[model samples]
Target chain A: MDITDNKENMTEAPVLLSVRGLVKSFDGKTVLDGIDLDVRQGEVVVIVGPSGCGKSTLLRCINALEPIQGGEVLLDGQKIEKDGKNLTAIRQKIGMVFQSYDLFPHLTVLDNITLAPQKVQKRPRREAEEEAISLLKRVGLEGKAGSYPRELSGGQKQRVAIVRALILHPEVMLFDEVTAALDPEMVREVLDVILQLARQGRTMLIVTHEMQFARAIADRVIFLDEGHVLEDLPPERFFTEPGTERAKNFLHMFEFEAVR
Target chain B: MPDLGLNVLLKGKNMQRLLSGLWTAMRISLIAVAISMPLGILLGVLMTKKNPVVRAVLRVYLEFIRIMPQMVLLFLVFFGTTGAFGWNLSGELSSIIVFSLWGTAEMSDLVRGALISIPKHQYESSEALGLSRSQTFAYVIIPQTVRRLIPLSINLITRMIKTTSLVLMIGVVEVLKVAQQIIEANRMASPNAAFGIYLTVFLLYFIVCWPISMLARRLEKKWKD
Candidate 1:
């Protein structure tokens, strides 16, 4: 009922996702160096960092989008590897929404959202369509079922992309800068949809530069720099009294940027 | 009024010869198209593979096909191969083989381009949704690739049909050869027959290729959205 009671219950929820010592590198250049994280059920964790600080890479590694050179990722206690036999099964439980809103251009919005559910999950077509249409309606895209991705605006496409991930009923959702590519005016619309999801108590791991949105939505704000977590604190503390000097300077730059 | 020999198209067995000749040309081209489409798609998918050995092999094959002229390929297959390896090949079979090879090469390259042109996010998002590799190809990659390929592939088909005229040089009795025979046989009777008959042949080729070009343009416009 209250903020403290909700926070306490969220902590009491079982760990739905875990990352232990994740190390990723591209061309022998380390991007995620020995990272450890855990996300509880119905919790929302927002990760914020400077450009190229591995915030996106860390989310990608958890979903097994990028191969982890060292360390392991476990979803619901089952280890997820690059080519693991159960990779798809595990991935089906972790939904991802990208910055560019990569909806299938050839498919209608309804088909785009229902594709994985019908084909991979083997859900019945009518059932998938019903769920997809409901999700579309919830996102304020009620009449967009027959429309293709190209016909939708940037914010509309991003909302459809979110619904496309939601119909599968993923245990954890990963938002990789879902609004970073939008026009400034459209950014609020997409963020509002994400905030609505947050209110529904969806377990999400978000990588974003929207410090204000991050502070507002995050249960715990994580500060990553140079491919390591520097501060993991409540948004109130992380935004106000960051533990490290690097975080303080990062927030200062953001504030200066806001002024400009 | 003096006749320009246009009536030859309806003359005794001449109509039959011309129609059958056109079929001969189309037969070779259509067969080549049928075979090349699937082969090229497979090779195209393979072309995107990161394996160096596969890439090198396909690159060499594509380059070799591109370098040799189609006529030279026909001659090599029909004449040189018979002399060197002692395998007698007919003109129709030779034309089919040459055209198939050329079409396959061009098509695979088109396919590779189409596949690469797809944004990386498409595949990444599909994978993120837990779609298997095959499912991703079937639902996501292949459908979009097919859309991008349609207009280009239709252009390729028209080119192939036009290039079948080259098979007459290799002694294939295709439409061009039929027209030539009719012109020569009736040269004394219809001096104007050359203009009339060749005009008819031009119209025939136009009729076949124009609709295809129109379809391509229509789809390109429709999908441009």
Candidate 2:
């Protein structure tokens, strides 16, 4: 449980992404109220909580995928605004992988991966395709270039979704339960890809339902409850010695999950 | 071996007139399709906008077109316009105008349905990838929408083609008109000319529409897989 090495590293690294007093609402009902967070460079922070705790909304607000009622998300000290002049540029720097993979059904795996780099980044087609093919190879999808999304397995599609976001070379990644939709047997493959990404020192903010996976990959674990951060600590500390009574009860809900 | 009373089709010049008449029907639908496709696409895009006036106007246009029969619209454009405006419009030209307006409305509705049918996540995924609104439309939204639209639009085309028989009411000598002419002229020579020639006309329509609906079904089946 000794994570002092990680703690020392966290203090020295600059904050790569931060949310400041973020407030979000839907139809006048508050979902995330006065939420603040900081994710350092080369860090992986996982957010977990009971359903409707606003973890997904927080990630979406970071990506500006949802309209925020108040406050801001910043990357590399620059504010990420929904209507900023350079919003698209800022959006490209914050990659997101969704629960459903959301691959374009009409596009081949290669096209899905290479689209943004070629279209938005204006990278050369040859270069983009070469990189995408190699990345596809790295994700163990060696020769699926021409296969459509419908042709791939859920795990394979999720891996392709990761590559789709990664090809843009974002500063940080936001994963909203990427494996939640995968078949149980397939979930390991997608999680393994994410674990490898963490080993390579990618800054990521993840929302996941897999408690064990969250504990294993996260440098920091944030427990959200009732529209605010209830606990933020090193996974070692938070898992072992969760601060609030709420956190303990939340942990208890997962204790009875039977392994099949 | 009777050819189902289809002997009327082979009579001197009757077959040629039917083919030419079929061509007349095609000309109206084809021109309408060509003109309506782009405008329909634009109007369909406009329909997605949340502006009150745009929604109200498009809704009114759609209801007007759907409630009023095409024959009534044809009458309005062909006879009513000519009588009121004192503009001499040929029957064929009048048919073309009426069909074009009808096709535009149908095409636009198809486009709107296709556009809205696209899942919201597709738009989100595109935007999250740094695609601008226009880029998302061109790269993601439009491609997916068009895929959904093709089968439906082909079905629409088939319907419009068959409905061209209505143009005869406006005095355009399309296929139905030609069939009537042939049946009338053969009344003395062939007792069953009405049944035979009308059957031939029905076969002609079947030949044109069958392949289109088949293509549409094939497309839908392919997408499902």
Q: What digit string (tens of lDDT, one per residue) describes model 1 on residues A1-260?
A: 12233666676799989889989999999998899899998888999988999999998899898888999998899999889999989888998999999999888999999999998899999999999989988989989999988999999999999998998889999999998899999999898898888878889999998998888888999899999999999898999899899999899987644465
lDDT of 1 by residue, B1-225 (tens): 767789766767886887788889999999999999999988998999999999999999999999998889999999998999999999999999999999999999999999999999888999999999899888988888888899999999999999999999999998889999998988887777777778888888999999999999999888774
Q: What share of the true interface contacts does each candidate keep?
A: 0.93, 0.76
- Model 2, A85-136: lDDT tens digits are 8889998898999999999998899999988999999999999999999999
TM-score of chain B of 2: 0.94
Candidate 1 regions with alpha-carbon error over 4 angstroms: A1-5, A8-10, A257-260, B1-11, B222-225
Candidate with maximal lDDT: 1
Across residues B133-222, which tens digit of lDDT does each residue of candidate 2 receive? 999989988888878899998988998899999999988999999999888887777767787788788999999999999999999888
Candidate DockQ scores, in order: 0.80, 0.76
Model 1 residue B168 CA deviation in Å:
1.4
Candidate 2: residue B121 Cα off by (Å):
0.8
DockQ of structure 1: 0.80
